[model samples]
Target: MTALGTYVKVWLALIALTGLTVTAAGLHLGSLSVLAAILIASVKSSLVLSFFMNLRSEERVFKVMLGVAMATMAVIMLLTFVDVWYR
Candidate 1:
């Protein structure tokens, strides 16, 4: 529990960031709103994954694994969209 205090601080910071993201979404950025939200959400997710999951100090291979998973998902989603739009 030695690092408990640091963990709490990080969580609080993440929460604040999340709040900012939500508030920004409400400001009507038009087409950029969802992009901004996704960007912020990705950052917040990185924080949660690295700290809350204790993956920050993990091996390089683990980082590669996460990247690969993200890439695969992105490719799949984009392909589906392309298929729908090009049909």
Candidate 2:
């Protein structure tokens, strides 16, 4: 298959995953619903990043950049959570 064909497939799958996330929000799952949503979103994001962004075959530098970016965001999230934790 062509690159475009793979892209279309991934895009359609992402759409379905999005619908699932929205559907999940409507259902009651006690305290685990939010966690489930985050997990699915992460998976969907990975699919886009790997296929749409073409990161799966990229060079090591690109992977390093992604790691750095993700780490920075994680640090910021942790800092934010610190305040929430204290509250």
Relative to the unseen true structure, what is the Cα RMSD of model 1? 1.8
Q: Per-residue lDDT of 1-87 in model 2, one digit per residue for the tens?
A: 246789889989999999999999889886889998999999999998888888989899999999999999999999999999998
**Clashes per candidate (backbone, < 3 Å):** 0, 0
- Per-candidate RMSD, Å: 1.8, 1.9
Predicted model with the maximum lDDT: 2
Pairing residues by index, what is the TM-score of model 2? 0.84
The runs of at least 3 residues in candidate 2 whose Cα sits more than 4 Å from the true structure, single-residue gaps closed, are: none
Candidate 2 lDDT score at position 10: 96
The TM-score leader among the candidates is 1
